[model samples]
Target: MDQTRIGTFIAVLRKEKGLTQKELAEQIGISDKTVSKWETGNGMPDIAYLSPLCEVLDINVNELLSGEKLPSEEYLGKAEENMKHLMQENQNNKNAGRWQGLVGIALLAVAVFLTFGLSQAKIGWYVDCPSIILIVCICAACVLFSGCRTKYEVVHFLRKTVLPAGLVVMVIMVPALLHSLSDPAAIGPNIAVMVLTLLYAAVAYLVLYVAETRMERRRKQN
Candidate 1:
């Protein structure tokens, strides 16, 4: 959209209607300064103000966005152009969401590998510490990524990502657990760490679910 052209159109329409900027602004419930800004190409109306402004100017929203007084015969063409622009914008957003999902999955996989590596070592609470931090951080990244807009999508993404990777960690840990079981000094502590890791993973899943649900609600409201 061309702001300057739209502003000029607004100014021209106001003059043709024989109304001052202040009077037009009054009808639209905005300050005269806002009308001045629009006319001078310094600003555009908010989404909420678009309808009222268009009504006052005797123009449709498409004409306003296009920055012109469209001819009757060209109206449909202009509307079609606007629709394509909107669809392109939506496609771009979806592409961004896909990128975020890929990154989230990759991060989750890395966290899983780190946990698996830690399981083979004799580190005490450090195993839980770094793994817990990674789980928390990755969960936050998932929520922030905007990759899953619906509950089903969110769960599917987690299942495809977290569950498979988690299973790999478990599969690799089985042999280690078996070996540790034969060692009296290692058995109890290793089981305790595994239990703590699983508990933290569950908590991470819960946090992601709640955060994503809140975000979805907010997105819908907006």
Candidate 2:
């Protein structure tokens, strides 16, 4: 009933057979321009030409009309199973993303409190210790959140294994950086923390870049 869709399907199959518009038209006994119009969905082929056109394309009548490749019974069952799995995966990803956002916001609030409250209180060695720890924890959280937003391919394994590794590094670095902030002699650790924070932000940006690349590839493939 959808003549435009039918025409488009015919055009695609014609091209896949490596036949030019003129060649296809001649083989089907139609004007070359008529093939062009059909391919462009501007017009439909005459009912009389439909059967012979399918014969030339080496496709069945149903295939010509539907445009979907006819799958074997076994393949159709597998495809349905895969579709269900993909739908469940998408739902899980959405729930995980929501939870990650909430946790990241909570961690950021804690970081802000430690950075401002402790630094201003000027508790020589004690306050700086916790402040540095909080900042490093924030950085680790940002990395985890970035992984949550990244595609299944790049971050999938890393999110499960390597992200927790980052937490360990954060635990060691934060207190050391905070301790350095209290002592004028050890300013290097404070500077290192700033540099590491910048790098973490850069990593987050890289994740977005990777995600965009994956999106573009999917668009083209589709």
For lDDT, the strongest prediction is 1
Clashing residue pairs, candidate 1? none
The global C-alpha lDDT for each of the candidates, from Candidate 1 onward, is 0.72, 0.62
C-alpha RMSD values across all candidates: 12.3, 17.5
130-210 per-residue lDDT for model 1 (tens digits): 446555455446655847776657664663355334344445556778999779899877777666666666655665575
By TM-score, the best candidate is 1
What residue pairs are clashing in model 2? none
Candidate 2 wrongly placed segments (more than 4 Å):
72-222
- TM-score of each model, paired residue for residue: 0.40, 0.31
Give the RMSD in angstroms, all C-alphas superposed, for model 2. 17.5
How many clashing residue pairs appear in each of the predictions shown?
0, 0
